[model samples]
Target: MKQISSSQLNREIIDLIQNHPEIDDFEVLAIDLSGHFYGKRYPIASLKSFASEGLAFPRSAIVVNTLGEPLEGIYYGEGDGDPDAQFSLIPGTLSVNDWGNKPRAQIMATASSGKEATFFEPRNLLKKVLQAYQTKGWHPTVAFELEFFLFSRKRDDQGLIQIVRNPKTGRPDSPTLLSNTRISDFERVIDNIIEACNQQNIETGAVSAEMGAGQFEINFNHHSDVMRAADETCLFKRTVIETAKKHGMMATFMAKPLLDQPGNGMHMHISVLDDKGENIFNAGNKPQQRLLHAIGGLLDTMPAAMSFWAPNINSYRRYSGGSSCSPVSLSWGHENRTVAFRIPLAKDGAWRVENRVPGADANPYLAMAVSLAGMLHGMNHRLDPGKPCDGSVENGDEYLPLSLSSALAISMGSEVLIDILGRDFIELYCQHRKADKVAFEQFINAREYDWYL
Candidate 1:
């Protein structure tokens, strides 16, 4: 008899079950530092009970690297046994995955204990920074533009990654570079990706062909709630990967999947709203103190935050000038793709700043946390970001930690960053990244055999 709000209606797992009876299975997922989600699938018959109580996943899930090897001294390993943290499902994310043979649904969940958010969790870390915004009566709106490559299992004669074939021509390459016609090559899977995002309420904006043979970019609309934006961004990446697999193609979010091709990147556009719901970043012709301080904070912290932005070793390979729009310097400019942070051209209230530091492989939750925290730090410290760069930045500008190892080292000693994202997360991230680097070092590459063997 009572009408429910759209959001409340979406959260009704029981209603979802009744509506989509075909969905017998559901995937409840949570992400680690590597942006890899781990969860168990369950039959829909137990959906309601499980949704109410939530699910418990290992705390080690947060500390481990891409290798899934756990950090040695973290809370997950420091204790005699790994502790379990119950994470509740994110409302409205119960998306129906009718892509493959399995007619299943999936939902994104966040780790939390009772009413308090687990500090170590990446999603929770973003929530903490959002709390800082809430305290100051400011709202941060964010959107993600993610670029990725579509590769078939087949490789070239040189063992190089080959792009997916054109559905129309049956040719294994994109002839029209950065053309919408190029999308026709992989139209089936691309359309599937669009449909999946729409079903998940991810508000996907545009799809465009990128410089890489198989690379494409998908844009998302802005969400005023930063936490929800982060969650949707995370889910969106997973959806892209999963749906691609269903179509017999591999979608890679690796920062630099191919050495000869353009690297994939995750570019985030940010705008803050005031108490009256007005975009506070609309600085008119001149820059406002708040906006400048925000930029200054980002620049000040950009070097240390590099560890999260470029989470893997391959991430740094994308930082070169030759790699289109992959910015490496701590510079901001008006609609400048050459700079790490750019103020896009828009109407007064529509103005937004884009942080191009994050690779497609970055954990959206952690990256957004870094961006929001930098904005807060700038305001709190009243810092100043200097003039924008005239030409393309080398990203090797002074004070920037360019390498993965160096970035991790800076992250280990950064008290300010620790205060922003939490010392425990910073520590685990550093240790785990070191292990990841070490693993790569211990192994000899085919190229190494060519040169030094």
Candidate 2:
């Protein structure tokens, strides 16, 4: 990433303050391991100095679990005294917080501590992976398709979540794949969400109703710079949640928010470009050998990368559900959604692979980082991807880790991931996830009593 000069940032901040006088406050955000934003809000008076001076939070803040609790038995948590972690603003992220009630602005920042960038930070991890491509004069153009469900604010007596009701007819929403009527029902809410995304500089493309009731899929425009694409994905999630809240609905990216409903997924589409700005995955409308090699690398690394894809316990539930789109096999095929990696049918320069294993709840930065790393490994080793499966294939030659514990165990000793993502991040991630697993196990859910009784 290019660094922004101090003078340039000063001028930009000055212009922002002058132009948006209604913005009386600003929120600086740093993405955590769980893909949640952690930061403090400051008054407009401190915006300028805050930019140069930066801000500080506990080092453990970036490594917290989904519940926002610091993991035990790690240097970031109880093992080491939680020290102050510093953060510097990421250039080009400052935008108006249009979803908020008051006129406020927000910006994303990079994590650091004592003059060194935090190795375990998800964004920093992605930067490390991108460096490998940078050294080889290869660039990745990437986009993410996010699926989510909207629910009513109220819950049943048992605290189970209920789907959103149509405001016009007061009827409960039902699953209707690609129904224009469903999309029309939520037109005002969807329009507001898109408007908010536009204000945040997030380029949103198609918006369609999905298979789950109150579910929708939004497509983000592709970016030549993979880092910027990941950054916008993070911001887009926040924008959706806040914008939905404003319209009296609750949007959740949880992997399995409802047991009986189709789960949310975050599918990634990526294509590599050579130094000459040519798509290396295809040549003269035919798939290149390098594309197959990349698929092989993704297949070999999928088990190890599974922990990152399905980061939470509930994420595993998505794979078991009867959803054809949630791929579990190490399979790849042309225009097939049932496989882990699908080579979409496209024109010469538009050829790309769509990775469909990650849940919407996974951290986008880490997920994309591991995916790109796998491609690099495949191309470097010239690995062969076995024959592509035909229509409606169930299982592949090998299966992915289905449980969080199993995924962690496979990733714990993965030399491929360690070499690509560094030993510190790999070990810390495993330890943190294991800690979360233990915490999850200790909890006794209602299902346990219902079954045993």
Candidate 3:
């Protein structure tokens, strides 16, 4: 991970305090492997000391289950005596978080153990991949398009999810794909989200209604710095969640939040730039060799990379077929949305590949890292992506792992992935995921009672 000077962190806090004197509290947080933020809050008076001496978090906390519980066999939890992992704020991340009742400031931090990046940290994995790109004089430009759903704050009598009603018609909302009227119905919520993003220095692009009821997608502006893009994505998720609550609606990023509705996806747009700042993937409106190799690498490695994108049990439901808009095979094509890697219609200079396999629930840092690693692997070996499909392809579940257990098993056996990401990290991640699956299966759902009774 990139190091931030203590002096720079201090200056940022000072500037924030000078600008917003009403900020009575400060929150310092670190991103966990599950994409959840955990940290401590302090009064304004402690900001100065907090900048110099960082907070202490357990190293085990970095790789906990989605519920933030310590897995039984993980060595970091009790075997290591629960050692503290030092955390300091990332420079330029300190900003005013006014999405609350009272104005409070927040900062995103990174963890280090004895001045080295922790093996369990997702940010460290991404940093390692970025360094590999830097060695080859290549830079990656990336943007994330996140799809999510808004539900009523109240649930049904049976505790099932309920769609939010249309403010205009006062009726239960239904699929209103790309409907301008549907966007207008939630204008206030969208406006607040945009304003919140602006306050946090997050660059946003188009906002449109999606194919599912109360569903919408927000596109982020492309960034030359991939790390900043992932950082802003983490912040943007919090912004959308808080802003939705302000409007009496709850927002969810679950890949398949509702059983019958379309699943949410996080599509990544990525292009590689050479030292001369030329897009390597662009070749005069034709497919470039580098681009094809990159696609080939991604397709070949999708089975191993599945555990990173589809980390949860519910994530596989997104690819269960029937208008899910989720990719179920490792196909690639030009101007086709049905494939895993879509070379979207763009001019020569702006040409890039869009990876649509990741669910909105994935950790942005890890997802982007694995994608880059696969592309590099493909280019180094000059792998071919096979023939491009002209039309829609059938859902070939056999081409990819469709279960959490199967995905993790494939990930553990991938020598290419182990070479890109460290062996320790891969083993630890698979173990953690297996622990989560065990916990998930322990629960008896209502289906068991309905079917067996």
Candidate 4:
């Protein structure tokens, strides 16, 4: 694909609306530290201005924790003087949301401030990692398999939380078995999701019902560019949540919702290719064992990387053993679900490792960034991960943190993470997450435990 310049992006925006006609507005988004969307929408008429000058948003808007607490030095420490950044819309990612009476086009944007771009911005972070591979005459491809839950809107008599269910099944909290296969009772919502993805030109591999009640997973096809993969994952979550709300259902990407059932996860499949467009993981004369060692690197860093994978307090709940889903140890085997990484037994280009540590709640940009960092470390240091774990991983020596606090502590001391993501970024991330952890723990005291969950 050819590189798009600002003038070219502006022209494309005008031409896009002219050809599509249904698109009335465009959303320019920036992924903040929390991996949440921090952006503004503009009328199509303002496309030229937005494309050229970009939108002016408070730098503080992207630096705070979810609770809005300001990180002391991250935002203002650099001097807050109108810290504006350009947002160039990715051409192919433009899509329409038709849930409203009028359709609106949505586009993902990468933020750039002066010569030094914000590396913490998820998209930019992924772009930077991809550049590292590009410089080595290699390219990275990624696929996202995301899982999430759908909950009923109704509350209990005393105003406590409860799960919605199928009336015929007589199970109030049981999963709803909608008769419409193509379009469940949630058809309109799913349709809206499909529409948004199609409008954005994101390739949707499949949408399927998961094991848990009211749970679903959407898998996206692998893209050679890491940015496109991260962009798609970000948009997927936004589309699901927005569409679910329109249909009176709550869509949650929370890692674990119910203690007993399966928890949501975001598994990433990655592979590297050479400048000649050849799969580097493939073995013709070269042995595939080298690829296994790369998987080992990911396994070695699995514990430290958990902070990025399961960023929130609720994320660790997904790590329970009985589910046969979540990974309990750092191990990899061919097509193994019990292991942290799984090497799918497939053809040359199809061979790749699926890193299962990340929960659906993770920011795809950070997840990809950390995953690339691990792979690159393995490639550079030649770290050979031992034999893959077989059967249950409960007894396995390698284990991930049991809570967000533990994960943060490990991440804070991770030399590899600091080396790759930079000390400043790591410090900023840990500070924000540490604050979140403290707030969440304080709020969830013994008296409030049952009420909050």
Instruction: Point to the candidate with the largest lDDT.
Output: 3
Question: Which stretches of model 2 miss by more than 4 angstroms?
Answer: 1-5, 113-117, 396-398
Tens digits of lDDT, candidate 2, 1-453: 224555666777887888998888999888988888988888978877867887788878888877888666767757667788787787778888766667788888888533553888888889889889989999999999999999997899999888999867789898999988988889998988888888878889999999898999989998998888999988888888988888888999999888788999999999999899998887667788898999999998999999999998899899886553688788899988888899988874588899999999999999999999999999999999899978866663445789998899999988999999988789989988888788778778899899996
Better of 3 and 4 by TM-score: 3
- The digit string of per-residue lDDT tens for model 1 on 1-453 reads 112423463467767777887788888888887878888888877666666666778767767767777655455655748767787777667778777686788877778633432667787777778888889899898888899888886778877777787767878776355697887757888889989888887788878888887888888888877777888877778889888888777788999887777788899988889899987777676556677788888888898899999988889888863446788777988777888888777775577778988999998988988888988898899998889777766546768887999899888988888887778778877877787677667776689889987
TM-score of 1: 0.92
Record all residue pairs in model 3 with backbone atoms less than 3 Å apart, i.e. clashing: none
Q: Model 2 TM-score?
A: 0.96
Pairs that clash in candidate 4: 95-199, 95-200
Clashes of each: 2, 0, 0, 2
Give one digit per residue, the lDDT tens place, for model 4 in 1-453.
Answer: 324566567677777778877666777776777778877778877776766665665555666666655554455324566365555555556556665667776666666633354656667667666777778998888899998887777666765445645433535444433324523544566667787778777778677767677777778988886787888888888888887777777788888887867889899998888888877788864436658778878977788888899898778888863353788677787767878888887664466788987999898999989999898878878888888766655544435676788788888899988887888778878777776676656543555767876
Task: Estimate the overall C-alpha local distance difference test score of candidate 4.
Answer: 0.74
Question: Where does candidate 1 stray beyond 4 Å?
Answer: 1-11, 69-75, 113-117, 156-159, 175-177, 285-287
| Model 1 global lDDT (CA atoms, 0 to 1) | 0.79
TM-scores of all candidate predictions against the true structure: 0.92, 0.96, 0.96, 0.89
Which sections of candidate 3 miss by over 4 Å? 1-7, 113-117
Better-scoring candidate (lDDT), 1 or 3: 3
- What ranking emerges by TM-score with the best candidate at the front? 3, 2, 1, 4
Q: Quote the positional error of residue 112 for candidate 3 in Å.
A: 2.7
* Model 2 lDDT, residue 304, Cα: 94
